[model samples]
Target chain A: MLKISGINASYGKIQVLKNVSLEVEEGSIVTILGANGAGKTTTMKSISGLLKPNSGKIEFLGEDVTGLRPDQLLRKGVALVPEGRQILAGMTVLENLEMGAYHRKDHDIASDLNKMMERFPILKEREKQLGGTLSGGQQQMLAIARAIMSKPKLLLLDEPSMGLAPLVVADIFKIIKEINESGTTVLLVEQNARQALKVSHSGYVLETGKIVAEGKSDELLNDSRIIEAYLGRKSS
Target chain B: MLIEQLINGLTLGSIYAIVALGFTLVFGVLGIINMAHGEIFMFGAFIGVMITSTLNAPLWVAFAGAIIITAIMGYMLERFALRPLRHKQGVSHLAPLISTIGVSILLENLSHHLFGAGNHPFRASFAEISFQIGSITVYLVQIVIFVISIVLMITLSFWLGKTKAGKALRATAENLETASLLGVDTKRTITMTVIIASAMGGIAGILVGMAFNSVTPQMGLSMGLKGLAIIILGGMGSVRGAMAGGLILGLAETFIVVYGDSGYRDAIAFLAIIIILLIRPQGLFGQKIST
Candidate 1:
């Protein structure tokens, strides 16, 4: 439902995303795997309207949405859970959730808030607690729940598992699968290649702002280069 | 005698408190200290006086007219003066700060032309009755100023804490980028913030004019400087800090004038700020400086 074609994004004169492009289907979880400084976040920023691309177009669900503001994209049912989980640290968990749906004029928001509280019980217990005071895992959960609170047709998650424990990472991936199964397409950016491939239907391997490889998740998992670059020692 | 001074100090302090909140609200959201905020206050007071003296209007009419006009001025200051500079690449924080200083000078001069830099009587023709409170007598005007300030404070707290529009404002203040991603129209939030904060300054202007029975284009000059001292003494970007700091400075000024000398009243705000910073550098209620 989302297509990015030859988008070039830059910070000043220095370009970060060089002719990068990717597609996210209507009901599939697409993962973009890359190491640090590989332009993964820049691509997401281009799509989500944080950074305007220097050239090319971004079509979301068939409308040309390039150059729109972040809030504008959100109003159109595209939500991004940015890197580092950028929670409003001084705000309460409930406020954070409410902010996730700031543009919605719908009356069902309270009911959706209740549904989120039910899904993430810790959120209910800590509803009034400041977001900065939450544990890393709990913060990640809040970030995801907050993004989904917008009821976006497409959710872009950037490194949700970064700095998380192994068990918590597994749980996050499980939650991603659950979210995808519930009908929201996810475009996930991660360095956790193994778990990402296992959870995704198809994936692209980005290297230094260029897409180096793209195929079925299982095929990319077995690709010798992907294994060497991302999978590391299979024996471990 | 003590009770009389305390109440008088409180009456004056509430005026300072409202002015300080005006400064703090802009600083909190935009992270830019609007030097022109003092002029907004001054302008509002002038408007109040003009309405009373020229229009022969009631107090409420002058009050509403001053707030609405100043609020528009606040919105224009953000939209026209600051937004363009804010978006420019490689623009340092100093750029916006310097521009506001320019706006301050311009507004002061404009007011000088409009009102001729002279004090005007405001509601002085109205008969004011003083009622006895124990050993102290309080003017009806003083009572009005204090009660209005308290009501304003309560309403402001409720709006900031409980309303969705207020939450959007706080969220933008906390994190601009994240707030945008969450569907907050940051441009609108920022504009509205300045409008509300400037209206606060307008409120202070009316009250001070009423208390002193006169208004001048130069009045905001000293009060503006006092606002800076109060925020520094209270804590930067804190509403409660502004209120508490204003009261302390007000009480200090009142006592100094009564017991020490009238000359020391103006210096009280700066002296208190310096002393407070020496003991607790973050002001009375500020968080530790973050990286």
Candidate 2:
């Protein structure tokens, strides 16, 4: 449902994303697996229009969406749960979720909010508490719930498992799978290759702004080279 | 006599609170100290004077005119002066602050050219009217100013706490990127912040003009400096802090006038702010701005 073609993005004098291209099919979780400085977050930012691409095109549902601002992309049903779970710190949990539905004109927001509360009960428990006061895992849940509150057609998740405990990571991954099964396409960027590939249908390996490998998730999971490089398997 | 001075202090404090509210609102939403804010307040006072003198309008008309005119100016200031500098390369985070100072200078010069440097007195009908309560005298204008300031502050707090747009604004203040990703039109939110803030300044300006019976091109500087002190004293972006800070500064000034040397009012008021800052650093109601 989303196509990024040959996009190059830079921050001032330093070029980060160099001729990167990827496609996310509808109804599938497509993850970009990469190490530190692999331009995964940059790709997400470029797609979300937080960063203007130096060159190339981004198409969302066959529409040219390159250079559109984050808010504009959000209105077009694209939402990003950014790295570090950038939840609005000073806002209450309920207010943060309300913010997710900021651009909506529908009256069913109250219902959707109730649904979100049911899905993430912790958020409901802390609905009145300031978002900054939440634990890291709770904040991640809050961020995901905040993203989903927009009722996004395409959800871009950048490092949802970052800084969370392993058990919480597993839980978050399970949630991501469930979110994908519910028919919202997900573009996940992660350093956790095993969990990311396990949850995703398709995956791409990125190294230093270049996508080096692209294949079905299971195939890449067993691919000897990928296993060695990403899954931390030492070749004997 | 003490009660009279207390009332006088509160009236002045209410005016400062109104102006400081404008400063804090902009700072909260944009994270920039809008130096032009005081100039906007000055513009409001001039607009009040112009509307009253030229149009022969009532106090309400002048209030409304000042708000409308300064609100538009605030929007323009954001759109032109502040927003463009936001995305420029190598632009220091301090650029917007400095640019606003330039805007302030430009505004002061423009008003100086338009209205001259002399203090323009606003001849409100209620300026001379007073009622005695026990031994204390209360001017009708002072009561009006205090009531209006309180009403505006309460209304603002209500809007911020209860309304959807208000929540969006608070969210924007908390995290602009996250708010945008959640589908908030952050540009519009910032614009709304400036409009509301500038309107607050305008109202304060009109009230100040009516209270002291004088409006001048440079009036905003002194009041604006006090406003800066108020926000710093209260906490940079805390609404409650600004309100309390305003009253504290006003009371400090008035008490100094009553109990201490009248000439030491400004000095002592500012000294209290410094002492508070040295002690708390974050102001009374402020949270440390998280990185």
Please compute DockQ, using alpha carbons, for every candidate against the native two-chain complex. 0.65, 0.68
The weakest ten consecutive residues by lDDT in model 1 chain B span B282-291
- Quote each prediction's TM-score: 0.97, 0.97
Query: Which pairs clash inside model 2?
Result: none
Off by over 4 Å in 2: A234-236, B289-291
Backbone clashes, candidate 2: 0
Can you write out model 1's per-residue Cα lDDT over B92-123, one digit (the tens) per residue? 98888888889889999998898897778778
lDDT of 2 by residue, B134-205 (tens): 878999999999999999989999999989888888888877887777777889999999989998898998
In model 1, where do residues sit more than 4 Å from their true spots?
B124-127, B288-291
Candidate 1, residue A2: how far the Cα is off, in Å: 0.5
Q: After superposition, how far is residue A116 of candidate 1 from its true place, in Å?
A: 1.3
Lowest lDDT 10-residue stretch of candidate 2 chain B: B282-291
TM-score of chain A of 2: 0.98
